[model samples]
Target: MTQRREAAIEKTDLTPLAGAETDVAPLGRQGLKPPHELTADEDVDVTQWNRVAAMDEFKSLVAEKRKFIIPATVFFIVFYFALPVLVGYAPKLMSVKVLGVVNLAYLFALSQFFVAWIIAALYVRAAGRFDEMARNIINRLKSGRE
Candidate 1:
């Protein structure tokens, strides 16, 4: 390598080595605080969280969300794509005026924006119930009832 290229490569190589030396400790070496030094709740209980997640209530919450979201997504996709299909295949019908300076196709395409917003608002409202269920599950876990 040329002198400049060798110098640049050496600089980059040392950068990561310098960082790793400080970031990662050597094998079998204790970190700043040993494992036993931490309290029970100080560390997150992944197994307890996993058990809570595997509960029937959690499954039902997910199912309820999917019930609304999946259908709403499918409906929106069909509705959104139908506009271009109608415009391409039935220009005459799409040109038919329903309001002043607004053709059927224009109205339909514009309505898609409103439809998306409405669906989002509906989902947000429905999510309140899901949030309640999640809070209940979390409370049960915290209280050691689960």
Candidate 2:
């Protein structure tokens, strides 16, 4: 490695964060702030909520979550990793006669966009079910009888 001539570094002036001149309107700045609104949302009790859940219940919930994650990851990995490698390494694999002009690699490249759309759709479908299941489990765990 070759060494270059060192450049001079300039020091910056450090000052207090708020400064002496500024009139800070902290949490009371309401006009600048967006309007606060509330609806039929459950107000969670922080103290009791922080209490430890049973080990078995936690374990079961984790296991169920893993069930959703693992398969989805496997599916995503196969399509995401394998497809790119297959596209790069074997572009000839996708190439074929179409209109006696165009190659299939061009077509396969376009198929990536379609595959992404399909994956997104499938993930949304799966996530909806997973979210519902998680909500049910959490509701069962919560103390409030709402």
Highest lDDT scorer: 1
Writing each residue's lDDT as its tens digit, candidate 1 over 1-146 gives: 23454477885564432221123445787656455544344334546767877999899988998999899999999998899999999999999999987899999989989999999999899999999999988887778753
- Candidate 2, superposed: residue stretches over 4 Å from native: 1-61, 144-146
The superposed Cα distance between candidate 2 and the true structure at residue 68, in angstroms, equals 3.2
> By summed lDDT, which 10 consecutive residues of candidate 1 come out lowest?
14-23
**Count of clashing residue pairs in every prediction:** 0, 0
Candidate 1, after superposition: displacement of residue 141 in Å? 0.7
**81-126 per-residue lDDT for model 2 (tens digits):** 7667877888777566564766666666677688878877877887
lDDT of 1 at 88: 98
Candidate 1 error regions (>4 Å) = 1-46
Score candidate 2 by lDDT: 0.57
